[model samples]
Target: MKIALLSYSTKPRGGVVHTLALAEALAAAGEDVTVWTLGRGGDSGFFRPVDPAVRQEIVPFPDVRGEAVGPRILRSIDTLRAAFDPAGYDVVHAQDCISANAVSRCVRTVHHVDHFTTPELIACHERAIREPFAHVCVSAAVADELRQGWGIRADVIPNGVDSQRFELAAQDVPGLSRWRSRLGRYVLSVGGIEPRKGTLDLLEAFALLRKSEPEMRLVIAGGETLFDYRDYRTRFDARAAELGVEPVVLGPVHHDELPTLVAAASVFAFPSNKEGFGLAAMEALAAGVPVVTRDLPVLREVFGTVARFATEPAGFAAQLRAACADPGSRQAAGRDLAAGYSWDRAAARHVVLYRGLLG
Candidate 1:
């Protein structure tokens, strides 16, 4: 069977990563897989290379003249892509809203719902893409949101971590020696620096936590998101300084190095107000590190009974403290939960879904 995946931007975002992983998994199971997307900055003018087995094509959509490109440009590219690649694959999987709106049927499309907020966005989404034959939500909560808000039902397919890439050792060993000496027992949060990611809330919780746990540090991984990166960075840096919470913001570490960073942490703190699925928390759990997240439905669904959930900032701070105190309990629980989550299993699920669609 041959499968084609469509998305607007195939950059190294979480959704893109998920698509690439699924494509690789499908290809590994003897399906011919092809990915289609637009060209991005600093990348080769071809399919964003993943597995050698997977084929990719990039439709160039460059912003011409000194003017900014918006919906018109995207629509042009989408029109061209849809017209050119209509009958090549057995199933066409569209990741986000952009790709979903562009392609029409007899392509068995899978639209992944990462988040469902804003009625305007929903209306635009419906107007843009043809209703998919099937939709996949990373968590049950996400599926429920689509059902409740948009009147769309979707299948629940939790994001799976590559356990081999995120295994833990006997102890928390800092792989990077330079930062290892300075960075001691800290709570780790990995995501783009954005308010929706709850970076500000995490900082607030950490400020309160530092009053009791003075020696504790907060290690933040990844760079800025949609907002003004410069302003957000300055404000966050200043807040940390003011609170005297030793904040280490390492901008965008390589995905390969994430496991070591996660394993080195005492606890993984994810105070995200929004999430399609808590991949970082799952990764931390996979690395045998305890996780403390907010009372979000998706987090609850993904972590189940293994993670500590807090209703408020105070509660979150307390949970973090408790998690830090008896790290072994969380580690044991995490190891147990992490056992079932693997990219192999996730890939196999994709293979089944694709085969079923083909049949």
Candidate 2:
């Protein structure tokens, strides 16, 4: 079968990651697959190299200085719609709201539902959910949300991890030594300082944690997004100052270096207010790092006993302390759980769904 998997950007966000991985897995299964995306900021390729068997179509998108978020989103949809041609594909799958809006008739994977107050975003989110010929969700909790909100039924397919890559990083003595030398023992969090990521909550928790573990540092990495979060970022900075804590913010770490970084973390923090599937937390598990995440139904479903869960800043601080005190048992359990999710299995299920749709 010939298929097109569409996403909004070539960045390292969760949905983009899913698109690339699923495309490679489909190609490995002897199906012809192509990934279509807007190359925002002149990005000619993805954050990491893709397999040669999978084709890529990157549409050039220049930056519009001083443009608002709503306008940028509308322009993104228009730019992708103008460049994409759907005539030669057997199935077209959109991985985010922008791609779903760009394409005519396609299948959409609702990774998570967002609550928006802006007029453009509200309309865009609604159309993307209601107009797709079929829907897919990465977790049953998210699928159930769609069913409750729009009366739409969706197939639930869990995300697959590149477990071996991280597993190998855990054993890289030189790499671990290098990071440990530079950062000392630290708590690591990916996904930047955004509101939805609960960055302020994590900052507060880190301050509380320092009372017990004075030498521990907070390291944040990998934050690239289309939306404007300047206001939220300003508030985050102010809060950090008031709490007298400084965090090392590494924006967009190299793809090759990520595994080593994750593996070297004393613990991984995933305090997001909202999530579809906790992919970053799962990667930390693959690296055999103990994980402490927000207590949500979706995360509880995904991590179960493999991770430590907490609700607020105080709770997060307590959980992080406990996990650091003893991580051996959870680390082993997390590795086992991470190894069970495979890209090959996810691809096989997707192929079945596509065939059923065609029939």
What are the lDDT scores of the predictions, listed in order? 0.70, 0.95
128-227: candidate 1 lDDT, tens digit per residue: 4337777777777877877886676666666767665677432435473434566877888888667667887788898888878888888988752322
Per-candidate clashes come to 2, 0
In terms of lDDT, model 2 sits at: 0.95
Checking candidate 1 for backbone clashes, the offending pairs are 101-128, 101-129
- Which candidate ranks first by lDDT, i.e. highest? 2
User: How do the residues 133-251 of candidate 2 rate in per-residue lDDT, one tens digit apiece?
Assistant: 99999999999999999999999999999999999999999999988998999999999989899999999999999999999999999889998889998998899999888898998
TM-score of each: 0.84, 0.99
RMSD of candidate 2 to the truth, in angstroms, is 0.6
